[model samples]
Target: MNIVRIPFSILLLLLTTSCQPKNKSDKPETPQIVKETVAPKVEISLEELQNYETAYFASGCFWCVEAIFESVKGVKEVFSGYSGGTEKDPTYEQVAYGRTHHAEAVEVYYDPGVISFTELVQVFFGSHDPTTLNRQGPDRGAQYRSIAFYKNEKQKKIIISYIAQLESKNIYGRPIVTEVSEFEIFYKAEEYHQDYEKRNPNNSYIRNVSIPRLNRFKKNFKSYLKEDSH
Candidate 1:
């Protein structure tokens, strides 16, 4: 994806608010009170989540990806996180600035009976430009790279098969650069990052990038989206 220059005023707004910004120094310190207030309420408990299956994906900014998945049917909860790296408990700064190998990722808890892993894989590829290496929209770096994580052989084959089908059909008109990797530990991002799009709709990055990306997904995948999401 090509980088578009934000207007000076919006750029200033992002510098003071966005979690992922063009410049590292642009990130501001979020207040603890703000974090507590903005954190999304978890509708499901850990015990109930154990009854559902979990899928992982890394496609650009988790803020956009998380919102997209949350709108999909059968997805009970979506979490913004860091994955695809060996670093332990990586901080947002470390991952955002390429100090760690981790990429911005999400943990998707879904009901397998309601939405199959195959369909979720479709949503993953459909939501973002997988052909763009180490970049998504205006964000650039390994931290923003696309990755589809599989927890077992069945899930792995499903992801690979879908990619093959896309390639056979020449879906993107370019080689799919998305990484298909085995599942690893996922470090949940700071509380402030959770449900960021919902809480910070006016944020420059959310308005300019995240919401637009999610709207595109909703437009294309209406059947996959929950009724309320429409």
Candidate 2:
């Protein structure tokens, strides 16, 4: 059998005790060893998703963003991916290291009837700090930059209007720097990244940063979450 070589940087990261990046570096490490516990299974077929509407957002680590959106009532599924850049089929390493312009993003499939696009925008802004530039919590890089993508003019108007309202209210006490871009292609992240928080419950990053961020969103938006999520 051919042995696959793991990059030294990646190996070192995995061996570290926390997913938090060292002060000298902004790379958030992940655990190399996967636990035996599996994420809860909830598979939605592609055919069934045809009736659902899609939204895309990038607010930080996809792991945290994915989990937050998944908890919402109408959200059908959330997939970690890269967006807001021109690179085609970019890898995690390329995006994570800022080698590609793409930022870590998520593709959300939700029922418009159950949840409106306006509400989804609210969740997007409510969950993460949009005022920060190219950084979220422990991860500090362009890949973690905030972005809200719109597929059409209507969606674009909604995002712009929300930002205006937030600015008017001075919600963050700073200017929101989130990017409002047109929806383009979305390259799904590697399989290991899918449901990462659920699968790696004990992971340092998951336990500390990811879970806390998710919990904060849940608390602030209690009515938006699904019953099972609580």
Candidate 3:
């Protein structure tokens, strides 16, 4: 993430504060927070990104997972998609019915140079309640199920170690039921769903749940969050 400077925003805020003193509402009328500008990610060739790695997890709404992964420093992209199902290229509507066998998951594309797969797993554990089986918060059913889609033997070991560490530390009163499986199918979601939280911030679900989730994560992992993701 790269910071963006806009003098107009400062000008607008000054004008609003000085020009409209009549309405003395408790909440001040303020301009929206300006976000940082990031250059479009040049699509990485499969061979180049291989130096990094891929990981996946399903812990609730894809919007939340996508937002969480994007906060991690090493992560290149977090895609909202469906996986661990037999279906092929399932549509959002089809998956919503809970018949696709897919768990709404986020695929993390990250650079190993900036963060390790082990740390990514830690972020996964921190971002969502792993004890909730087949659910995260209020959302229920298989689509919102928790699962760790491991790409290889290394990821399996990393996931196992993290779970054991959490269990030994008594992190939660209940047992963790997150599924650990070898990755197979991954169906990219619809185009608009790529960055649901960032793209549709005004939508009811995105605004109420997704943004709050992202904000909480930002507070927790201030160091890991991408500089511009804030």
Whole-model lDDT values for every prediction? 0.82, 0.81, 0.70
Q: How well is each residue in 56-174 modelled by candidate 3, as lDDT tens digits?
A: 88888787788889878989777778997998888766665575899888888889889888778877777777887776765667788788878889889888878877777667656
Better of 1 and 2 by lDDT: 1
Backbone clashes in model 2, listed as residue pairs: none
TM-score of each: 0.86, 0.85, 0.77
The ten-residue window of minimal lDDT in model 3 covers 1-10
Once fitted onto the true fold, the runs of candidate 3 whose alpha carbons sit more than 4 angstroms away are 1-51
**In model 2, where do residues sit more than 4 Å from their true spots?**
1-42
Q: After best superposition, candidate 3 residue 136: deviation in angstroms?
A: 1.0
Taking all chains together, the TM-score of candidate 1 against the true structure is 0.86
Query: Compared with the true structure, what per-residue lDDT tens digits does model 2 show for residues 1-230?
Result: 11111111222223333332343446545324455465554667889888789999999889899999999999999999999999899987677767789999999999998989998998988888787898776677889999999999999999999888888877777899999999989999877788888888887778767887788788778888999988
Q: For candidate 1, lDDT tens digit of each residue in 1-230? A: 11111111223223333445445255644223233245555557789889999999999889899999999999999999999999899988788878899999999999999999988998898888888899777778899999999999999998888888888877777899999999979999987788888988877777787887788788888888999999
Per-prediction backbone clash count: 0, 0, 1
How does candidate 2 score on lDDT? 0.81
